[model samples]
Target: MALLLLAQIASGDSGRVELIAHPEVGAQLLTRDTTRAIFAMRQRTWPDGQAVRVFVLANEHEDHVRFVKERLAVYPHQLQLAWDRVVFSGTGQAPTRVTSPTEMRERVATTPGSLGYLATEHLDERVQVITME
Candidate 1:
């Protein structure tokens, strides 16, 4: 079962997503752990110490599920549970949720200190891609 899960994860679905940040973020690369931390709301600042603002598609969104599983190596349910625990315990807040990829691009582009994932084709000059280090 574990190997099967690993294989499935190793072969994520057809779509490709990119980690995108506001142009002002000034970060060209981030380690997988750091990227996960930011998305998990566990790390609140970038290496440069700017506050990190996280964005996400709705929990049920296909891209959200794919990115969480493929990039973060976890199921969407796990991420949701973590967010719920933090929110209920009053230690952190849930990420801003956008309904569509278009909204995601707009929000991440206009919001400072923002980070989110988008299908590669949705990426544009308004935001820069953060390569996994």
Candidate 2:
């Protein structure tokens, strides 16, 4: 089961969806643990004290969402439920969902405090790939 799951994660679906940030941004925003921390709402601010902005793909395409969810043992419905609760409680906002990986990358690269994911093939010098721990 572990091997199968690993294979699923390694297989290229829509392509490799990677966490990305602007070049000027440091490694503080990159890493599997950090990604998990952000998604889990542990680390709310960047090392520089800027509010962290999060971006998510609109759906479960390319298995990226599943990767994160399973890797973190985060259930999809639970995540949605948490988001709904946060929304109603007026706590924090859910991630801004984008239509495509390109859109995610573009938005994250251009917007300050933004962090997002994209296919590895689409990554360029303008964006820095965040490493998974």
**Error of model 1, residue 40, in angstroms:** 0.9
Which sections of candidate 1 miss by over 4 Å?
A: 1-14
* lDDT digits (tens) for residues 54-118 of candidate 1: 99999899889988988888889888988898899999998999989999999999999999998
In terms of lDDT, the poorest run of 10 residues in model 1 is 1-10
TM-scores, all models, native as reference: 0.87, 0.73
**Candidate 2, number of clashes:** 1
Clashing pairs in 2: 32-133
Q: What is the lDDT of residue 65 in candidate 1?
A: 91
* lDDT of residue 123 for candidate 1: 64
